[model samples]
Target: MNVKNVYIAYTNCITPLGFDVDSNVQAIANGVSGIRLQENSTLMTAPFYAGVIDSDKLNTAFAALSDAKATRLEKMMVLALDPIIKKSGVELNAKTALILSTTKGNITVLNENAVPVPDAYLHQLAQNIVDFFGFTTQPIVVSNACVSGIMAVSVAKRLVQAGLYDNVFVISGDEVSEFVLSGFNSFQAMSDVPCKPYSANRKGVTLGEAAAAALVTINNSEAKAKIAGDGSINDANHISGPSRTGEGLVRSIESAFNEAGVTAQNIDYISAHGTATPFNDEMEAVAFNRLGLNEVPVNSLKGYYGHTLGASGLLETVIGLESMARNKVFASMGYDEPGVSQPINVLAANLDTPVNCFLKTASGFGGCNTAVVFQKVNNGR
Candidate 1:
C-alpha cells in the first residue's frame, strides 16, 4: 500500500482576541486574554468570565461575504473557513472534501426556539456550510467532544492517505451560549475568573467560543507543519471525569510517538488539554510524567483562549505550528505555581527556543482522548 504524506498549510481563527491568526497570536504574545466577565441576566445568576466573540464585530467582518440569514454558529464556521478555502485554489470536486468538527453545532439556534430541532443537528450544520461554499463531496462531521478538533485533523489525514481525497478543509467551532454556560454551571466547573491550567490555585474551566479552520493536503508546498503521528483512545472510565490513572491519555501519546517513530525526548513542546479542572489537569500531569515527558515544557492555551471546547485542540495545533516557526514558546498564561501531583514542567514564561516537534493532546467527555504529533518542515515547501 502506498502512503501519502500530509501537511497543514493555511489556518484561520475567529476569536475574541481578533478575527484572524496574526491578531490572535499577537494577543497571546502580549500575554493578553480574551476571557472576561460576561453579564447576562438569564444565562447565569452571576457574571462569568468567558471568551466570547462580539456579535457586532462578527457581523461587520462577515458582511463582506454574505448577508443571508444564518445561525451564528453557521456564520462563524463559514467565516473561519472562507479565507483559507479561497486561498487554497482547490476546486470543490470529488477529490476535495469538507470536514466539520464541533461538540455543539447550531445549538444556539435551538435555544432561540427554532421551529425545527433538526436545525441543530450536526449534519445540518455541515450541510449549511457546504451550501455556502458549494462543496460537491459528502460532508463529514466529527463530534467527539473536546477531541473533535484534533480528531478531525487525524480523520482528514487518513482520508487523504486512503486516496479518498487530494485535499480537505477542516473546520471546528463552538459558541458560548446559555445552554453551554448552564451545562458547565451544573458541573460547578465554571471558574469565577480566568482559568489557570496546572496552577495550584486553579479552580475550574472558563469556556470560550471560537472557530478554527485549516487546509490539509499532500502537496508539500502548502505545508506549514507535517502531521507525523496521531492516536485516539477511550478509557471508558467516567462520562465527565477522565481516568485518574491517566491510562487512556498515556496510551494515546505513546501510540502517537510510536507512529511518528520518535520518543518523548524528540518533542520540544506540548500543547496540552488542560481544562484547569482538578481531575483533567492531574490526569495530564500523571500521563506526561509516566511517559517520561515531565521535563518537556508544556502550556495550555486555555488561559488565552479559555478552553474553546471543540475548537481548542486544532487552535492550539495551529498556534503550536506558528510557535515553532517563530522560535518562541508562549507562556502558560495564568500559571504562577506548580499544581499537579507530578513534576511535569509547565511553562511559566515565554522563552526563545527552537521547537521542531510538538505534541497536541485533548481529553474530553465520555472518556475520549486524542494526541497528534506535528513537526516543522524546512522551507514550508
Candidate 2:
C-alpha cells in the first residue's frame, strides 16, 4: 500500500485538567495532574481518582444534539466532533470516513436496560455517531482493547494510502462505570492515592474516563499534524497481560522506526505508556533500554491524564504533538522517585529542546501494543 500523507487536523479531549485540546496542553505544560477524588456520589464509591470530564458540562453539550436517547459514548463522540467540524471549515460530507476506537463501548447503558449490553454495544456506538452526523459512508468501529485509538489512526492512514477515502474521523472514548472499576479493583490494581507511574513509590492504577477525537486526511494541509510512521504487534505470550520483558513493545518500536525509515537515534522524545503498575513500568523500561532509546527524554502522560484506558494512546499522542510543536517537553507530574534499574531518563523538569521526531506508544491488557512516529512540518531530517 502507498504510504499516504496523514495529518491530524484537529483533536478534542475531555479530561479532569481541561476540556479542549489547548487547555489540556496548557495543563500538561504546567505539570498539572488531572486526577482527583470523584465528587459525584456515584463515582465516590471507588477509592482511586480519575480524569473525569465535567458531567454537568458534558450533559449540557450532549443535550444540544438531536438524538434524545444517545448513550454516553455517543455524547462524547459528538462532543469530540464539534470542534473539528467547526474548525476545519470543511462541511461534513457524506464521503468522509468515521473510524471509532473504544474498548468498552457504551457499557454505561447496560445497567439501564436501554440496550443489549455487550453484544450490540459496538454496533450501537457506530450507528449512533453515523446517524447523528448523517454520513453516507459506513462507520468503522475498532474495539482492540487499549490499542484501539492508535490502531484507528493506523487504519485510517492505510485506507487513505490505498485511496479509499480522503478524510477519516477517529474518536476514542470510554466511561468509568461499576463494571470496569470493579474489575480493576478486583485485580488489586486500583490506586488509593493518585497514580504515580514510573516512580519508586508507585503503587497501582487509578481508573480515568476520557474522550479524545482526531481528524485526519490524506490531503496535506496547513491545519494538521502529519503522520510520519506507525507500527503495531501482538505479544502472543499472554491473553490479558503484558510480557515481563516487554518483548512486544520492543518489536513494535523497532517496526515503527523501520516503517519511518528512521533509527532509534532519530527519536529525540518518547511518550511512554507508563501505567505506574509495577510490571508495566519495569517492562517498558527494559523494552526502551533494549531499543537503545534509554537516554531519550521520556515522560508518561498517565501522571497528568491518569490512565484513560482506551483513550490513553490517542490522548497521549495529541499531547506529544502539541509539545513538539511548542518545542517544550513537560515533566512527569506524579513521579517522585525512580522505580526501575534501567537507565531511563524520566523528565524531572520541563525542558526547552528542539524536538523533531517523537515516538508515542501504548500497551494494553490483551497483549496488544502499538507505536506511532510523528515529525513536525519541515522538521524531519
Candidate 3:
C-alpha cells in the first residue's frame, strides 16, 4: 500500500486583524497588531489587552452567509470556512469529512446563569455548522487544549493517508469571553499589555479570539503546501504548566523530523508557539536547542494576534504557508530581546529569504505538544 501525500489546498482566517488570509498577511507585513486594551467590564473588572473581533463587522459579514441565528464563534468559523469550501468545489458526501477544533466552543453560553446550553457542548456546536453546510457525514471534534488546531491538521493528514477520505475540512476557532478571560486571570496569566513572545520583558498571555480554516486533501494541483510529517506527544509534566526540560516538545519535533526524513538544517523557518508566557517561551527555546535548531529563523505570531487559544496553531500555520509562498519570514512581533535561557535565533525583523520548508509547533495545557512539517510543492499553482 502506498501512503498518500497530504496537501493543504485552500486556507482562510477571520480575526480582528482581517477577515481573510491575504489581509491578515498584509497587516503583519505592515506591523499592525490586533491586540488592544479592552475595557469591557462585563468581561473583566479592570481593562485588559486582547485581540477581539468586532462584533458588528463579524455580524455584517456573517449576514451574507446566513440569516439564521448563531453564536459568535460559530459565525466566525463559518465565515472562515465558507470561502474554502466554495473555492474547493468539493461535494459534501461520504468521501468528505469535517473536523472542528476548538478549546472553547460556545463556552460563553455557559456564562448565562452558569447553566449549560445545547450549543455549549462541543459536539452540538459542530453539529450546527454541519447542518448549515448540509454535511452528510458525522462531524469530528478536536478539543485538546491549545494544540487543538494543529492537532486537527495532523488528524486530517492521517485520515486522508489512511484512505478514509479524499479530502478533510478542518476549522478551528475560539472566542474571548468572560469565562476565558476569568480563567486566565485566575491563573494570573493575563498580560495587561500586548503579549510579547520571547521578550526579556514579557509578562503573560493576552487572550485573543479568531477562527481559521483549511482544506486538507490528497490533491496537489493548486496546492498551497504539502503536509510532509506530523507528531504529537504529551509529557504529562503538569496539568497546566509545561515540562521544564521541554520533554514533550522535543520529542514531538524529533518525531516530526524523523517522519519527514529531514534534519534541522533542512528546515528554513519555524513558526513557534510563543504564547509569550515565561515558561512556554523558555521551554520552546530548550526544545529547539536540543534538536540543534538553535539558528533556525523562528517567530511567534502571538504578538499580532495575541493568544487565540485553539485557533492559534492553525492561524499561525496559515500564515506560515503564506510566508513560504512569498519566500519571506515575518518577524516575531513584540520580541525585543531574548528572554529564554537557551540560544535560538528568534526573527527580529522581516527577512526576505528562501522558505521552502517550515515547522509549526504548538504546546498547550496538560503538557500536550504537536509538531508538523510542511513543504512547498515545486509545481503548485
Best by TM-score: 3
TM-score of each: 0.98, 0.93, 0.98
Model 2, 1-381: lDDT tens digits are 445667776778877776688988887777788787776656546355877777777788777755477666677778877678667665557558889888887776666675546434687788788777777788898888878878888888777767788888888888777777888888888787888888988988877878888887865564346677887888878976789888888998888888788888889899998888888888899999999999999998887877888888888887888777888888987888899878799998898997888999889888999988887766231
Alpha-carbon RMSD, each predicted model: 1.1, 2.4, 1.0
Which candidate leads in lDDT?
3
Q: Would you list the C-alpha lDDT of every candidate in the order shown?
A: 0.90, 0.80, 0.93
lDDT tens digits by residue: candidate 1, 144-189: 9999999999999989888889999999999888888899999999
Q: Judged by lDDT against the true structure, how good is candidate 3?
A: 0.93
Candidates sorted by lDDT, descending order?
Answer: 3, 1, 2
Global lDDT of model 1:
0.90
Q: Cα lDDT of model 2 overall?
A: 0.80
**What local lDDT score does residue 343 receive in model 1, on the 0 to 100 scale?**
87
Error of 1 at 367 (Å): 0.5
